[model samples]
Target: MHGLAKNHLKKILSTCSANRDCEYYPCHYNNQSCLWCYCPFYPCEDEVLGEFVKRKDGTLIWSCMKCNWIHKPDIAAEILREITELTLDKTTECSIDYLENRELLMQIKNKIEKKLGKSNAI
Candidate 1:
């Protein structure tokens, strides 16, 4: 892994905790992992996992409320591992930027879909 990514990943992984006391405890399901309170893959735009909803203001925004993929412990761990491995050769100003790379995002999505035997609808 890249030096920066390794350090950042270590920091993030170290802080993983289940905040069951939060008001939104079990936000997605009874046993969902709280490691990702805010999804790193926001606005993933993956129709299978999420969709765009139109608000009363006539504006549409991606809603992942129904998606529980990342909340699964195994999936979350796999995602972090994939991210670390994928960034081994790439360089970015911020380690988190790797998540924003289109190709990397697609790869992560594909892996999740494969593990779950689902197809992408995006």
Candidate 2:
């Protein structure tokens, strides 16, 4: 391939590259890792959902990028609904000190979206 063509290909590869957030040996950052290639949850490519996540029970759930239509393992999610129904008798103060992880999540979503667009899946 010509030098300019090679450079252009590299730009495309950056967004298409697969990465492993898990601490696995010999990650495929170079050319081996097969990360999230497409919207894994939604069935139809036209309505590609954002991604799939594993619940504490190891069940998979697909969440919409635009909406909150989480699906899959309907039975598993029922536990969550039940939990929400129950409440403590007494009021108690609670807080969550979580750092902003939106950027990281967005980066992964944008990369996946860009790759899907390149393949003309939309």
Against the true structure, whose lDDT is highest?
1
Clashing pairs for model 2 are 28-33
Task: After the best TM-score superposition of candidate 2, give how far the Cα of residue 60 lies from its true spot, in angstroms.
Answer: 24
Estimate, for each residue in 1-122, the C-alpha lDDT of model 2 and write its tens digit. 99999998776454333333335412322333232233322332234434576789999766444322222223113322332333233233321111123443344335444543322212
Angstrom error of the Cα, residue 7, model 2: value is 0.5
Pairs with backbone N, CA or C atoms under 3 Å apart (clashes), candidate 1: none
Off by over 4 Å in 2: 19-122
My TM-score estimates for the predictions, one after another, are: 0.69, 0.19
Question: Which lDDT tens digits does candidate 1 get at residues 1-122?
Answer: 99999998766654454456668877787766677778777878978788999999999999998887787777767776777787777676566675667777777767876876443221
Best by TM-score: 1
Residue 45 lDDT (model 2): 28
In model 1, the Cα lDDT at residue 116 comes to: 61
- Distance from true position, residue 102, model 2, in Å? 18
